[model samples]
Target: MLHLRAICPAERTDAVLAALKAEPGVTHVVLLRGAAVDPVGDVVEADVAREATDQVVASLCDLGVDRDGGVTLEQIDTALSDAADRAEEAAPGDGADAVVWEELLARTGEESRLNATFLSFLTIACLLTAVAVVTDSPVTLVGAMVVGPEFGPLAAISVGLVLRRWDLVRRAALALAAGFPVAMLITAVGTWLGSRTGLFDPDLALAGHELDFVFEVGPFSLIVALLAGAAGMLSMTSAKSAALVGVFISVTTVPAAGYAAVAAVLGQWDICLQSIAQLAVNLVGVVVAAALVLALRNRRGQVRDLGRPLGNG
Candidate 1:
């Protein structure tokens, strides 16, 4: 279930109430007339079935509630009312299977932003991967992959492609294009610093590291990339946080970047080129696969919506 809070203009309060009453999946409607001081409107609140979120939200938007007022939805983790159960039963489809597109758009938009935290995660992940390569440990490599925030922009890019939101695509592309280079630069500097200590020897590490096989760009790597991308997209659409961690390990995104950084620092141009190629392949694989998955999901949603009566789903 979800809790919806809306600020509706005084004149539109009746329309808002009518819309809520019309939705079979909506219940426990609470209205406070002229109670929104900042917006100078009526405060309307309701509990809605999760499956009906998209439609309910769309209806509110159509009423222009978002233009002059505000509409916000928050998940109701625990709805103790028997009315909530009745509302859930009235809604079509399972709640978990529903996709709230506006919510996704808002979330991906935030995730795609290249902020300080994003940069820090990417840089730290790359540094960890570099350490994994030097230490020849697969565990550390997986750690690095899990810590990487590159998936945010990748998911954003996929969403943009599916929705044909070129602005979103451009923003995500810019984030990825800028973020990787910065992370690689950090990785390189970190490697150089580590080399200053007797504990690090790039040449020796390169000769026997397990990651050499990981960096090898080949058909198998592409296969893994495709699978990882598909899984990652599914995880995002389903809101499966645990599944995302597996995706982190499945794709070679951060590991490839880390390997390239270490190779560059060690002046192994050939290895660096291979790792770069590996990175490119993985990125393309994940992005393209995710886009396809989202496109298919969108089509299915459209078909289902078409099958339903107007204003009912």
Candidate 2:
């Protein structure tokens, strides 16, 4: 179940309650008249079934309740009420298949931030990949894959593109554009310093084909990336976060950057260019596949919601 709290102007209070009462998947309605101080409005709260969240939120947004007031939605750990059960049963689809647009906006926006933590994780993942490159360590390469933080921005790009949110698309693009180069540069420098100090082998790097899949741009690479992107987006929409880690391991963005850095340090220009190409291919595949998935879902949802668009909600 989802808990929704909305601060609505007193003038809109009756309409807000009307919307909630109209939805069969909403229950436990509570109204606190004149409870809102910040927005100086009435407070309206309700328990909504997960599958009906998109429609309910859209109805409120259409009322302009979010303009003069605000809406906050969250998950309820436990709701031991028959009304909640009836609401969930009345909802059209399975809860696990529903996509909450507002929740996704917040999640993807946070992921697309090019902050210190994002930079550090990308750089660290690439550094680990560089080490894996020198040692030809498959386990360490997998570790680097797991440590990469590019998933969020990639998801943001997919969601943003589908929703036609240009600002979000540009923001996520900036994060990737700014993040990869920085990580690669740092990894390259680290590799160079390590080689100079006898901590890494430039010679061994020449035979580093074990991790070459990262730079081996081909049809199969794009296929894997496309598959990973679809799965990753589905995981986010359905709130099955555990699946995202697997998607991370499937994509080769961080590993490619790591390989590019090591190859640059070893003076292997061909491999470096190929690695960058592979990285671009993988990112493109992920973005395209995820956008397609979201677009399809949105279109279907429009029909299911009786002309109300789901993505824009």
Best by lDDT: 2
Model 2 pairs whose backbones collide: none
TM for every model, in the order presented, reads 0.92, 0.92
lDDT of each: 0.84, 0.88
After superposition, which runs of candidate 1 have C-alpha atoms over 4 Å from their true positions?
Answer: 300-313
Lowest lDDT 10-mer window, candidate 2? 304-313
lDDT of 2 by residue, 41-123 (tens): 99999999988998898899889887789999998989999999999999999988888888887788888888889999999
In model 1, which residue pairs have backbone atoms overlapping below 3 Å?
A: none
Q: Mark the 10 consecutive residues where model 1 has the least summed lDDT.
A: 304-313
Q: Give the winner by TM-score.
A: 2
lDDT of 2 at 153: 91
lDDT, candidate 2, equals 0.88
